[model samples]
Target: MTLRPLLDPQLIYLEPAVRAYARGREILARFPQARQVEIDSHWRNPELYRAAAAAEDWLKLKRDVLVLGVKKGMTLRPNGRSADFIAPSSSNGCAMACSYCYVPRRKGYANPVSVFVNVDDIVRSLERHAARLGPKTEPNTVDPAAWVYDLGENGDLSVDATISRNVEDLVAAFRAIPNAKASFATKWVNRDLLAYEPQGRTRVRFSLMPAEMAKVVDIRTSPMAERIAAVNDFVAAGYEVHVNFSPVIVHEGWEAEWRRLFQEIDDVLTPAAKAQLKCEVIMLTHNEALHDVNLAWHPKGEDELWRPDLQERKVSEGGMVNLRYKVAWKRRWLDQLLGWMAQTMPYCTVRYAF
Candidate 1:
C-alpha cells in the first residue's frame, strides 16, 4: 500500500501551538477528499509537538470512521517464553517513545497504531476461516473451546490518548467471538476499562517497569504509580490481570527498583486477585533491539551482545540486529528473577519469557 506523508509538523514545538494554528480545523480542510484520517497518539509527546500538530491538522480535516482490525494469521508468536496472539486493536502507535523502542527497528517506523477502518472486513475474514475449519467434534476438534488472543503484542494497548477512542469498538468485536479470550497489554494505566463490564473474554495485561526507569526511558507514558492503581481497579472489577516486565532494561540499581515495584503491585492486589496474576519477566531479546537508538538509550558497547544465531533484518528506518541468550544465561536469569518473586510474593505465580 502506498502511504503518503500527510504532514510533518515538529512534534515537540507544535503541540502547544495546536490551538493557535487551528490544527484540527486545518486538517479538516486539507484531507476533505480522503476516505479516512488517523492521528497517532505517539505524536502527543511535547518533545514531538511539531509531529503531533501535523497529525492533528490531518485529523481535523476529515471526520473519518474508525474501525479496529485483527491480524488474520496466527496471532500468537513466540516471544521469550510464552506465545502471544494479536488481538483486535489499532496497528502499533505506542505513546511512550522509549530510547529502545523495538517496533521502529524490528517492525519499522510505520504508524501501526493507526485505526484500520476495514475492521468489518477483518471480522468477516475470521468468521470465514472459522467456518472452513468445520464443525466441532470430540475426535476431530476444529473449533477450540478456548482461543486466547493478546492485544498490542507488537505495541502497547492502552496508550490513554488513543485507547479511549478505540476501546469500545474493540470490546464489541471480540465479545462477538465465542470462547475467545482477548488480552490487552499496555504500559499506561487505563482506569476507564474498569467501568465497562467484562465483555467477551477480554483481559487487561499491564507491562510495568521500575518507576525510575520509566521516568528516564518511558517518555510520555503514565507513571508507575498510576499503572499500579489501574491494575488494582481492573482486578477489583473481576477482570483477569497479567503483568509483563519485558525487555527488562538493566541499569544500575535495577534489582532494587524491580523489587520495590513488585512489592507495590503485591500491596494492592487482593488475595484472590493475587492468585489470578500471571507475571512474566522478559529480558531484552535481539528481535526488539533493532531500533536501539530511536529513544536514544543504547549503550556504547552493544555489539558485544550480538550472537551469530540471531537473524538480521532491515526494517523501514534502519538495520535490526537480534541476539538470543545462551541457554545457561537464560536459565540463570530466570532463576534469579523467579526466586526474587517467590520471596517477595510467594502466592503469585511467575513465568519467564524465553
Candidate 2:
C-alpha cells in the first residue's frame, strides 16, 4: 500500500530553559534545530493533504506530545490501580505509515516518520518525575518518597537507533532513585539493546504478533521471527521482558494461529524467562474521529465485524470516525487466553485490558 501524508491540526515550538550541569541541557542542545508542529488541526489544510498524497520525498519534521493528568479535586480511584499520569513520549514523533495504524486518523498528520534529536530532555523529565515519587523502602508499593515513571507510551523508542540509546540513559537516571522503575514498549527489533548492559531498573516490553499475522498487518516493522529472536536475546541478558499481544485481531483461523504462536513461545522460551514474562492482550479502541476514517479505509463488509458500537463524529471542522469492539467480546477472549496461559505456564502472570 502507498503511504499518505498526515494532516496536522496545530503547530507549536517548545524551547525549555536548562541549567548547565543538568543532563537534560545536553539533550536539549542536540535538538538545536528541532521543532514541534502539532497536527491536531491538520485536517483543514487541503493543500497539505494534496501534497501528502503525491510527494515521495516529503519528510515531516515535528514532535507530537499527548498529556494526561489526574483530575483535580478528586481522590485516587477507589481500586487504587489507576495511574496518576499517562502520556506518550515520542522518540521519533512520526510513524512508518502502516496500513493498520490509527495515528493518521486521530492526529490528522500526513508524515509518518520524524526522528527526535533531543530525547535527553525527555529522559530527564522522566527522571525528575520519578525522583519526586521518593525512594523505595518497601516492596510492591511506591515508597512515600519515590516517584514512578512510565516511558514510551506515546511512540516506539527504537524508531531511531539514537533514540533507543536514551533507554540506557533513562535507566541510569532511574537507578539513582531507589524505588523507581521505567517501562519501555516497542515493536522494533533493537539488537543494540541486547549488547548494552541495562541498569536493571528499566523494564522492556515487546509488542508482538504471530509471523503470518505480522506479515499481513505490521508493515515497515521487523518480521515476527526476528522480533522473537530479539526477545530471547533480551531475556538472556537478564532484563525484565514483557510481551504485549495487543489488539488481537480476530481474523479467520485466529484460534489455530494463536495456538501455534503460543506453542512456539513455549518451545523456545527458557523456564526462567517464562516465569518473568507478563502477557497482555489488548482490544482496539479509537477516538470518535477515527470511525469514518477507518470505515473508509476498510469498507463495512471487507473486514470482520469486530466492533458494533463504533460511531462517527467530527473532531474539528474536519470529519473523522472512531471505532471500538464490544467490551464483553474483549473480556471473553482475554479470559480464554489467560486460561490457556494458566494451563501452559502457571508461573507467568497474564494480564488483559478490559
Candidate 3:
C-alpha cells in the first residue's frame, strides 16, 4: 500500500526570485493542488505569522503551508561538538514537531518546512569554504578524517528528503569533497535516503530517546526502534552512522529507561555499524518561550521538559533564557549515563557529551 503524502500543502508562499529555479518549480509541480501566493520575502510574512501565532492550531499551518525562497547569506559558523562547522541550510523549519525543538523559537508560531530553492548556491558556498580549509591536519571531536559540516541544523534532512532533492544533492556534492563531510541529526527514518550514495562522506545521526518518552515529546517522528533497526542498513549503504542522545530529558526512571535504550542499541547494531559508531549526548535545554508554546500545543511534553524544581535558568550563548538540569544534578546524570553507555555499548565512542 502506498503511504499517503507526508505533506499535502494547501498553500505555498513563493518568493519571486526563486520561482524560476528548477527546485522551486519542482516543488510547485509537486503540490499543484495548493494555492500559491507570491511573497516579497519568506522571512517577512507578517500577516500569516501573526494569524498563526494567535491560533492554537500551530500544527495546522505546519501541515498545510510551504515556503520556497533564495537563501541570501551563506555563512558557515564554527561548531565544536556535533560538527566542526554549521553550514548554510539547504532548508529551514521541519514537518515533525518535536516539542523541545529550538527552530520554532525564532520562527514565531508556525514552523513549516521552508525549502531554500537556491540549493546550487548553497552547495557552491560549501565547496568554496571547504576548498579554503584544504585538508584536516588534526583530528577533532567531530571527525578523525575530515571537516564535518552540519547540513540540518534547523531541520531534519530525512524529512527534507520527502519534500525535495536537496538532501540528495548535498550528499552527492560532498561525495567528491575529500576534506569535508556533511552531517545531520534526524529523528525520522526515511529509507529513501539509503539510495543517496553518500560514499562515507555523509554522516546520519539518528536522534534517539527512550521509546515511551519519545512518544511524549518526539511528535510525528519515526519510532525509536525503526531508527535503531536502520543502523546496519545505513552503514551498508556507505554512510557513517551515529546516535544522538539529544535533549536527554530527565524525569523519574529516566536512568533506567536510558540504560535499556543503550542495551537495545548494542543488541541490534551489526559489528560494522558499531565499529564506525560514535555518539553525542546533549541534556535537555528548554527555553521559556518554547515552554509557553508547548503548553499551547503539547502541554504533556512540558511535564517531561519544564522542571522548575530540578532545572535552573541559564542564558544560552545565543542569549536565549534556557532551563538546564541544575549543575550538580546534570553532572551526576551525565556521569551516570556515560557509565551506563560504557557498560552497555563500550564500542560506541562518545565524541562529546554535556
Candidate 4:
C-alpha cells in the first residue's frame, strides 16, 4: 500500500458525475498533472485493461491511472470468510505491487484503483441492510455484538484513506449504527487513522508475514516491522486490533521464517496489545493467471507460489478458476503454524485458520 502524499499522479480519468463530486475534485487537485477523461462507467469498461499493454508496465503505470466514478450497485454481498457481509466497495483496486494479489487477475493490463465518489449512497445502502437485521438475534462466529461488514474487500483501505476520505466516512457510519461494525484488513500502516476515535466499532486486521517473504513479494507496502509496531498505537486509538497471518507462502525455508516471525510478534506485544489481539490464518491461494502476471516483473515470488506438485486447481465461489495447496498439504501447514502459535505466541487468539 503505497500512499505517497506529495508525489502527484500522472493521469486521472473522471466520469461525468465524478468530475463534479467533492471527493473527486480533491483527488484531482492532488495530482497536478492528472487529466480528466469521460468514461461511460468504471465497472463496464473493457478498453482500459483488455485492449493493449504489458503486465510489467502496469506495475509502474497503474498507480498513475486513477478512475473516478459512482458505485451504482449498492446491494451488499454475503461474505462468510471474515465479515458477515461484504460492504459496497469504497474502492475497487490497490496501489501496492503485491505479486500474488488476485485483484490483478481480471484486469488484463490496467489495474489501478477505481475510487468511487458517491460514499453517501454507499453508506445509505449499508444503513438499509443493517436495519433489516434488527440487532443480532442469532449468534455466529463473526460476532456476538453486531453484524460485521467488510469495508475493504477489494482494496486496501489504509492506502485508499490517503487518497480519499471514504475509509473514515465508512468507519464513522458504522460507528453510529448500533447494529453493525466495520472491518477491514491492511498491509500498510496509515498513521492518519490514529485521529479517528471509532469507539471500538472498527476492526483493523494487520496482515503479516516474515520480513524475508514480504521483501520478496509484498512490494511497495509498509515494512513488516512498521505494521507490527503500529499494533500498540492502533489498539490505543480505540480500534479492535487483529493479526492476519495472511497469504502464508510455502517455500524451502518457510518453517524457519515462520518460527522467527512468531517469535518477533511475541517479543513486540505488550499485555494490552496481546489481550486485544485475534488472528485469522489464510494460506496462500494462488491463481495461474496471477502467476503469469508476476513472472513479468516479480518472478521470484512465483518460484515459490506456483508449485504444481503441491497444488491443485479449484474454482472459487466467484467461479474464477484458481490454485491452492492440496488438502493434505494445507492441513499439514495449518497444523504446523497453529502449533507454533500455541507454543511461541500463546497469548494470541486464532480466530480462524485455513
Best-fitting candidate, measured by TM-score? 3
> What's the residue-level lDDT of 318 in candidate 1?
43
Put down candidate 3 lDDT per residue, 306-329, tens digits, no spaces.
999999999978788999899989
Q: Global lDDT for candidate 3?
A: 0.90
Task: Give the alpha carbon lDDT tens digit for every residue of 71-144 in model 2.
Answer: 11211111211122432343423444344555565445454333333445555555565565555555432213
What tens digits encode model 4's per-residue C-alpha lDDT throughout 1-354? 986442145667667888678887777787777776678878756666752256656655656677788888887899876899999887877788787888766666366778899899999999999999888988776777789999988889998887878888888987889989999999989999998888899999999999999998898888999999899899988998998998998888898999999988889877789997888999999987677767777788887788998899998887777899999778988899899888998878777888
- What is the lDDT, from 0 to 100, of the residue 260 in candidate 1? 89
Residue 241 miss distance in model 1 (angstroms): 1.0
The candidate 1 region of ten consecutive residues with least summed lDDT is: 8-17
Which residue segments of model 2 deviate by more than 4 Å? Answer: 1-50, 53-94, 136-148, 162-165, 286-320
Candidate 3 segments exceeding 4 Å error: 1-4, 317-319
Clashing pairs in 4: none
Q: Give the per-residue Cα lDDT of candidate 1 at 22.
A: 35
lDDT of 1 by residue, 237-305 (tens): 756777777667544466798788779878877776777677667765555443343313334324322
Sort by TM-score, best first: what order? 3, 4, 2, 1
Q: What is the C-alpha RMSD of each candidate to the true structure, in Å?
A: 9.7, 7.5, 1.4, 2.4
lDDT of each: 0.51, 0.51, 0.90, 0.83
